[model samples]
Target: MLEFDFCSTVSSIFSTPFSLGMFTEPLMLLAETAPPEVVAGDLAEPSEESLFSVGGILTLGMLIVLQAVLGFDNLLYISIESKRVEESKQSMVRKWGIGLAIVFRIILLYVVVKVIALLQEPFLNLISHPLEVHLSGHSLIVIGGGAFILWTAIKEIYHLLAVSDLGEEGDKGEKGNSVTKAISLIVTMNLVFSFDSILSAMALTKSLEIMATAVILSGVLMIWLADHVAEFLKKNRMYEVLGLFILFIVGVMLVSEGGHLAKIQLFGYHVEAMQKSTFYFVLAVLIIVDVVQGRYQKKLLARQAKLRLAEQPSA
Candidate 1:
């Protein structure tokens, strides 16, 4: 009954938005962070090919699908972030935020391809006999982005717990978000999320056009799904706890990646990226456990009700 009411309320809230979407950062978070792989062996630069050529079309199609898969975490973040805004303006914020993401990605796609080597250069380094540290623009970005996400996740969790009754950060979750601020944060994090996948895309092919096309297509899909994802979460609030924890873990992974990129070492232990396969396996286990636990609890409640009825008849 509680769940049913929640659904009805969600329907009333989003009835007009016909709305809108993350899927990537968390996967990276659970795995070891590594610099984007630059494909080995000299591959030919992307050449201008006929749009209708079988190879070009096939490559473009594969990339589009891949972008959607890789961007799920990205889409999830957008969905969650949009909910932090004024209810009346959520639809607009989500739509505009995604539009900006598409544009920023395209611009970033070209810039990274042009000056990627410069971005990879380490700009600072320090060392001791058993420990060393280095930092680069890329590493800095990862660290900064990770820190922001960590702060946001922790803050949201606190809000969920109502831990602010004694202070300013406590219960103002009902306040409307500044549209500008929300959009800015979305765009910034979206770029951080793109850093790796964009590199992976380059490793597969040299054609910038193919990458751009895939990005645009995926953004379109995101715009379509964003509202719907937000609504689902609003109705099924329990799952939002799971989503917040995933975001928190993603922040941890990004920070680890930054540490790895800087090649930090302490007490003879070098920082490293976690393996992707292991993280996915763990995520699968968590989902299975949550589902089983929920079902088992429901069954237990039903059993208790039966016992109560039997005792009443005896009395």
Candidate 2:
């Protein structure tokens, strides 16, 4: 030990900085301890600080779940809309669309978190008496988005029912808009769909970080699901009809929400917003009915095939 190699020691000392530089913060963080065990639980069995963290996490989780639920329609819309592009490019469009939507959502979150009240401010008024007509920026977006989606859904239904191979036609450049137009619409609708969830999240907990996290998580999930939905529709075209119908209902909800934003009343009946629970219940019923019908149809087909085989003479 007294006769240490001075050259080797100097080399080793110089290499220590290089070794440390190679390990990034993230790499170092991989060996973290359990916080409570490491910090001795900070202050005892449980503290207000710990409880507050748990509450924040719970709220974040709730917002995330809420965003996912409300974004079902938006995801459906993306799947359906991406068909306007070349078949090979549809998936790319979906991924990019969602990526851009997430960016836009975070930007919108910052903007809305600061000026939600301004968005809800009643400015433009067409009438002011018993049939008081007024509008806010928020109401305008909701109403316009509702009308756009309603038109799109109804148009898609009509096209699907009246003519076959709408997707194929688009592939052939016969029933499609420009790719730019398609992506623009996707982003716009995503914004409209996000408004409710973001507003609700703000109301629940005034934490921009939590709300943004929720939106980002929801966006990631939607991106993952959009592919599955598009693939499912491609494989099982029959379900496209069901998806379109659900989208139609989404439009109705948007319109109702917009009406609530405007506080419009007519014939002693105030135009009100649809509850999320009610919307989900109705959607569940629709899905159940569609699934039951699909199973019944399969059984009927199978039975018919059996009957046909029985009627065929021995080969």
Best by TM-score: 1
Q: In model 2, where do residues sit more than 4 Å from their true spots?
A: 1-52, 128-130, 164-175, 312-315
Model 2 per-residue lDDT tens digits across residues 1-315: 011232453355456764322222211122112121222222112323221476667666656766776678899999888887788788888988898999999898777755665776778776645665568888989999998999989998888777666676534633376677778889989998887666555444545666677778888888899999899988887788898998998999889878877878775577877765567778889989999999999999999999999999997
Cα error of candidate 2 at position 163, Å: 1.4
Q: What is the lDDT of residue 200 in candidate 2?
A: 53
Candidate 1 on 1-315: residue-level lDDT in tens? 001122343355456442111123332332223232332111234455434676667656656755776566677778778777777788788899989989999999888776666667788888887888888887888889888888988987877797445234222344456889888878888999888677656644556777788889888988898888888877666677777877777777778878888888988798885443444555566668777877898899999999998889554
Worst 10 residues of 1 by lDDT: 1-10
lDDT scores in order: 0.69, 0.72
Whose lDDT is greatest here? 2
- Candidate 2's C-alpha lDDT? 0.72
Model 1 clash count equals 23
Residue pairs in clash, model 2: none
**TM-score, every prediction:** 0.79, 0.77
